[model samples]
Target chain A: MEKILLKNLGRPGFHTIDSCLVNGGYNGLTEAFKHAPESIIQMVKDSGLRGRGGAGFPTGLKWSFIPKDPTIQKYLCCNADEGEPGTFKDRGIMENDPHLLIEGMIIASYAIGASVSYIYIRGEFVFGTRRLEAAIKEAYEKGFLGKNILGSGFSHDMYIHRGFGAYICGEETALLESIEGYRGQPRKKPPFPALSGLYGKPTVINNVETLACVPAIIEKGPKWFSSIGPEKSPGPKIFCVSGHVKKPGLYELPLGTTMRDLIFDHCGGMLNEGRGLKAVIPGGVSAPMLNAHELDTPLDFDSLAAKGSMLGSGAVVVMDESTCMVKTALIINRFFSHESCGKCTPCRDGTPWLTNILKRIEYGNGRPGDVELLESLCTNIFGRTFCPLGDGAVMALRGALKNFRDEFQHHIDHKRCMVS
Target chain B: MFSDKAKEEIQQVLKKYPNRRSGVMDVLRIAQRERGGHLVKEDMEEIARILGMQTVEVNASAAFYTMYNVEKPVGKYHIQVCRNISCLLLGAENLIKHMERELNIRVGETTPDKKFTLSTVECLGSCGTAPMMQINDDYYENLTAEKIDKILKDLK
Candidate 1:
């Protein structure tokens, strides 16, 4: 019910630095500067805030991953490369409330003892990138970002690095590579960004929405923050509910808000002459599809996982009866095939193979054993690939097959998509 | 090859970078803007020659991004409809049908009049404002057939 993350959106001149200042925007960073970095980290940890980025990684735990030594020059990276198929919550926050992201970045930088921060935005987000860069310039001019903020002994510099339009760059390591002015590709983990990232030093990468929520967490205190949602996944979250819904837009609510509220109450139900809800992809295309029966399931990381899906990026994609699952799978598979970084074998080979197979099925040219081949190929690529991208591709294929096997059968047997 | 005026603008962009190769993306962007949408193969070769980099490097960069249309000629107004999961559910299929019928061209094809080119993009990061389409650089959100018709008429 509380509008913390989206507090300034839709308000007059909310994009301006003056309007942001009037609403106590940079006050959190000033408050944070007064405290020790470890104390700020402790406060964040106590707040029970998790990453609003699909991963739902614990924000405090991720910050704690950074080394405490002052000699080491740690980096704070903001994952504004929102390439998830259905997610746009970050863009809204970045465009309308750019200063909030700046303030959050400053607080996060202070918490982790980071001197420099980078907001790596997607290349296609031309307007959002310009707005964010302008906001950063404004922040620097106002002395909220430059050296020794508010007469305190903390100094920070922020940069906006625009991506060259690669979905793989949404991955933290790939984002680091892109920020370093290279072709975006995912790096092997275990060295994880926190331990050895961005010039092989300790770095912290937080999502745009995750960082945007920090100022409110800092201002409202941890107890108030923890009480908003389910105990494990507490705090407010912004769900970008779209597709088929009458009032399709972003809705800010507690983490455990049900699918019913999102689809029916918030989004004003499906369009197209009161069409029945066919299916729902709870968290972008990467997350598995849930039928209308699963609408009662709570929207949370664990809850969605228990139902064989993920709370990925909070991009709730609704489907109506007119959608053909086979065609949908083919379309989604094409994205994976194109976006795969080709770091490993399974994803590099498997995605294209699956995409080709799905394409054949969608086009009414599928062979008899194509379904089995698709499943086997997906199984091989699911966990074997280097990054979660392969897993996403595999999950998308398998989820489509599982929920709509009859459609795949229809494509093969009938030699045409059943739903046109 | 780029014209003298275009070349001068590109040189200013190149100055921002330490190495010429670093300016490859910016040069390609400027060149595309100069020539309208889509870069020709010759453009890539010329850019590589201008930047003192290998042609493959420029080609590779051009190939990686979806924004750069390397092969085809683009229409004056490029309309990219978001047909990913979100937009798909929000009558993107119907919208696509309407676009094809109105423009008399299929996806990835330009209208005969060279006025409009329609293509489907994955996501424009405007899912919050779903059923959206991008014309050139500006976004038109919460799209309906009537709205799209009005937009096309305005473009015409």
Candidate 2:
């Protein structure tokens, strides 16, 4: 119920230094500077906060990945390149409350012993980039970002690196490659960014919402933060509920909030009067879709995973009877096909192949074995590609097939789309 | 080669990078914008000549980025409607339909009047404001058929 992360949003001049200062921004950084970096990391660890950026990796564990040696110049990268199919929570946090993310970055930088941080934003977010740039300038002018911060002798500098609108750059390694001024492509992991990233030094990447929640966690002690959500995935998350809902918008809720609460209570249910819930993609297109029977599933990392999906990026997409599943899969497949970096074979070849087949099915040209072929093609692509993009595409196809098998059959049997 | 005005605009981008080669994309962006959206094959070659790089290099960079509209002539007002899962779930189909009917043009086609070009873009990062569309650079969110109609009328 408490509006911690979104408190400064809608406040007049919230992006400006004066208003942010008035609204208790940078207080966390000021307090954080007084303690050792290890202590701050420990506090975050105790807070039970997980990354809000789909993966739900422990924020503290990610920070601890940075090498302890002071000799190495570590980097902190903020994944503001929110290119997920159904996710826009990061854009809201970056645009409305820019300082929260900035402040959170500063605290996180201090905690991880990172001397430099970069907020790599998607190029399509022209307004968000401008707002964040202005906020960074304000932070620099007010002496919150540069050399001795609040007279604490802790030095840190931040920069905003604009992406070239590649969805692949949303992945951590690819983001680092793009920030380092190369074509955005994912590198092999195990170096895992913590060991060798961004000029081959230790690095840490956190989502915009993940880092934005840090200042609040630091300001409001670990216990208070831990008490809010479920035991494992504690703290508030920004769920960007869209599609079919009457009040489609961003809702800040606790992690364990049920799907019913988010879809019905918060988003004002489906828009049409007679239409009932057909399905829900709980976390972006990468996550598996849940049917109406699964509405009671709690919205958390573990809970969603237990139900064969993920809490990916907190992008809840609602569906009604009016929606067509075959068409939906085609739409999602088209996105992956267009955005696929083509670095890996499975994604580069498989996505378009899947899309072409789906298009055939949707256009009433589906063959007898097209549905089974789709299943086999998805099997080849899943877990075999370089990054999560291929996996996401495969998951989307499988999800459509699992829930809407009848539709695929109908297309084959009737030789036309059932919806049309 | 780039015009003097474009050269001046490119210098602003050059200031951000220490090396001139790093400004290749920026120079291409400026040249594309100066030419009013679409970049001809000659434009890419000229940019390479201006940046002192090979023509293939500039061409590759331009080709890699989706923002640059090369070869084809785009409409005066480019409307990129987000048709990904988020937007689609929120009636992007209806939004696309409204656009098609209002402008009398199909997706990937420019209107006969040359006043509107409707293209469906993937994920413009405003999914929180779903069923949204971007007119040129500015984002118009919470799109309805009525709001879209008014927006299109105002643009005219």
| Winning model by TM-score | 2
DockQ, per-model, please? 0.48, 0.55
Model 1: lDDT of residue A343? 78
Model 2: per-residue Cα lDDT over A1-420, one tens digit each: 988767655665666777778888888888888789998999999999898877888889888988899988888889998988878888888887899899999998888888888888887888988899899898989899889888987788887766766888889998876665456789988878898987788888999998988887788889999999899989998888878888877888999899999999888888897998899999998898999999999999999999989999998889888888998899989999999998999999999999999999888899999999999999999999999999999987788789889999899889877765
lDDT of 2 at A193: 88
Cα displacement (angstroms), candidate 1, residue A82, comes to: 1.0
What would the TM-score be for candidate 2 when compared with the true structure? 0.93
Give candidate 1 misplaced runs (Cα > 4 Å): A272-274, A416-420, B1-31, B38-59, B70-73, B110-115
What are the runs in model 2 whose C-alpha is more than 4 Å off? Answer: A9-12, B1-27, B40-55, B111-115
The 10-residue segment of model 1 chain A with minimum total lDDT is A176-185
Candidate 2 chain B: worst-modelled 10 consecutive residues by lDDT? B13-22
What are the chain B TM-scores of all models?
0.92, 0.94
Candidate 1 has a DockQ of 0.48
Instruction: Candidate 2: give its CA RMSD in angstroms.
Output: 2.5
